[model samples]
Target: MDRGERFDRLRLARTERVGPVAFDQLVKRFGSAGAALEALPHLARRGGADGFSIPPEHTINAELEAGEALGARLLVLGDDGFPPQLAALDPPPPVLWTLGDPGLLSKNACAVVGARIASSAGLRFARGLAAELGQAGLTVTSGMARGIDGAAHEGALPTGTVAVLAGGIDDVYPPEHDNLWGRIREGGCIVSEQAPGVRAKAHDFPRRNRIISGLSRAVVVVEAELRSGSLITARLAAEQGREVLAVPGSPLEPRAKGTNDLIRQGAALCEGAEDVLRALAAPRTLREPDGRWDGAVPDDEVDAVRDRVLALLSPTAIPRDELARGVGAPAAVVFAALVELALAGEAELLPGGMVCRS
Candidate 1:
């Protein structure tokens, strides 16, 4: 892509309501980001939006400048250094701000995640497992949180690790990990989907977790409570068809409950790094990429389909296939219409192929 086209893609991605899926649809439907930007207002209007505006060029420029100032660079999708594993995700981040060595993304990786207030034994196990995995030639990846995450990174730092941050690449959360964050920049990598300077929010953790799982060949749950974010990452790893490994913790420990439950449900039982390595050796089926639209729907036909799809939507999200059946439209056509609705802020595309009116 040329410089101008790259700028357009960045602008489209940062535009309100234009998420990863919407960005993909716009580019595929219009043949280029430049063309997509030109058609965005019309598409939004056709989907019942009162107004639509692309982000100003200066805003994108400022973001780029900030990343540069922080020693980070933007890795737009399709760029030379973008990780292929992450690209294989159903809807990967359109752009990622990256710091430190970009080359680490090419290596085989595993995620080690667990409770922030972990027991001493859990921390020791995580650290040893991480070091063992690192020595076994796998890059350890984790969110830069306290307890288990910190221990894992410290163990793997002598080799390599990747820290997927929930906040901006330059912003440090939890306040006390400043030294670890700096060491990660020197030894491994720091990455985020959000623009520089943005603070971490409560909702960003799940999104961050998906990227963590997406970038790895497998995810290991050291210790987690039922409601913990570590479980969320494990679930995402399963959804992404990556291997899920859980440490067998004591039944009396609260943090072990989630891992035990996962093992009971057939997640691979992890005793040490050897378990993870053995699981990685097993061949697993990978999900094929979703088929793309050929942009065959005529403008008038799209309008009709949009209306029909809208009629089936409510505050309650329904499966995309169910909406397609209700509207008597082809699934691809319904998806295209929903993309337009999503970009217009008239609908939401949830996880698991679900959709609902916004």
Candidate 2:
């Protein structure tokens, strides 16, 4: 894609109410960012937008300029250097604003997520595991927060690492990690789905977690509470078919409950990097670049099927297979419809593709 096309893509992504899924569907159907930008307002209106508007051109332009001024650049999904694993996601972000060496994205990677207030043992384990993974030529990725996340990045720093920021790539949150953020920017990679000037909102953290999981072949949770963001990332990793490994923590520690629960629910138990490596050694489980888009439905047929599926959904969530049967549509068509409905903000695709009127 050319600069103008990328600019248009960014503009579409920055538009209000245009989430990742919608942006991707529009791009796939239109075959160009320019066309998608042209189509968005009409699509929104049809999908029940009272007033839809794309983000102003100058807003996007200024975002790009801000990034450039900070020595960062916007990296659209499918761009030459975007992470292959991330590109394979069902609805990858249209673009990621990045700083430092985006080249680190190409390296084999694993994610380590855990509590910001992790115990001393958990932090020690994270650092040791990260170093071992780094020694094996895997680039350890983390959120670069405090505790386990910080330890993971610091351990992998001598080799390589990647930090997926919840805020803009240029905006280092927590303030105290300023020096650590600088180190990663110089020697590793920092990425964010939001534009450069966007502040990290509460909702942005889960979105940030997905990228941390998506960029890696596997995700390791060092310590996490039941409601922790790290657990959310682990669930997303599992849904993505990426290996999820969790270090067993004592039952007494509330922070360990999430990881232990994951282990009980069939997530791999990781004592160390060797266990993770062994699990990854299985022939067909690790994601192959060639297989990323192997089974995706073709773009041409999505919209027609999407229209049919929307009519089946109601305010209550319904099982996809049941909806497919009720609507007398093929499973794939129902799947595409749910995806489109999700993109259009007419429906929500819950875990298991359960569709609900939105």
Candidate 3:
């Protein structure tokens, strides 16, 4: 992409309601970010948005400058050196703000995650497992939280590690890990999908977990309660077709309940780094890039399709294929309409290819 196109893509991403899915759809449909920007208002209006507003150019420019001032760089999707594993995620982050050595992202990686209030044995096991994985030439990845996450990064720091943050690349959470954050920048990497200086919210953690699991070849859960965020990461890993491995713990311990449940659900039982290495030996295929269409539907036909698709959608989530059938339109057309609805804030695409009214 040219410089102008790059700026346009960033501008489009920063626009209100333009998330990863909408960004991808706009780029594919309009063939360039500049063209997409030109068409956004019309599209949004057609999809029932009252008035569409494009983010001012100065806002985007200021964000870029802020990231640069922090000694961090932005990695837009499709840019050279962007991690292919992360790119394989459905609705992959449209952009990433990264600090330290971004080169660590391409290394063989495994995620070690567990409870924030981890047990002594869990912390020791996580540290040892991370050290072994790093010694075997794999970069360890994790959220820079307390307990198991901290131990895992500490152990793997000598080799390499990547911390996928829930907030901005520069916003340190928990306050106490400031030193560890600095150390990570010195020898490893810190990455975030949010714009620089944005503080994390409650919802950002689950979103961050997906990126952690998406970046790694496998995710290991050391100790977790049944409803902990560690389980969320393990579940995302499985959904992404990455290996999910959990250390079996005693059934009596609450912290072990999640890992034990994972093992019972057929996630690989991980006693040590060796178990993870063995699981990694199996061949796996990364998700392919989304297909694009060069043909364009006439404006009237697109309007009709949108109306039909909208009529079929309800507050309850429905399968995308079923909605397409109900609308009597091609799957791609229905998908494009759904993307418009999403961009207009009228619909939401849930996990498992389901959609519902927003």
Top candidate, metric TM-score: 1
TM-score of each: 0.96, 0.88, 0.95
**How would you encode candidate 3's per-residue C-alpha lDDT over 9-110 as one tens digit per residue?**
889988887877677767878888899999999888888888989989999999999999999978888888889888777767778889999999878899
Candidate 2, which segments miss by more than 4 Å at Cα? 285-322, 330-345, 348-355
**Total backbone clashes of candidate 1, pairs 3 or more residues apart or in separate chains:** 0
Model 2 C-alpha lDDT per residue in residues 219-327, reported as the tens digit of each score: 9999999988898999899878899999998899999999999999999999999988987887545332322212336545555566667777789988766887887
> Least lDDT summed over 10 consecutive residues: which range in candidate 1?
287-296
Worst 10 residues of 3 by lDDT: 288-297
Candidate 3, position 347, lDDT: 87
Clash numbers, per candidate: 0, 0, 0
Q: How accurate is candidate 2 locally (lDDT)?
A: 0.81
Candidate 1 residue spans exceeding 4 A from truth = 292-296
Question: Per-residue CA lDDT of candidate 1, range 1-358, in tens?
Answer: 7898888888988998888877777787788888988988888888778998888999999999999999997888878889988888777778899999988887899999999999999999999999999999999999999999999999999999999999999888778999999999999999999999999999889989989998999999999999899999998899889999999888988999999999998899999999999999999875655674335467777777888788789999887778888988776678878887987788997654678899
Displacement of residue 160 (Cα, Å) in model 3 is 0.6
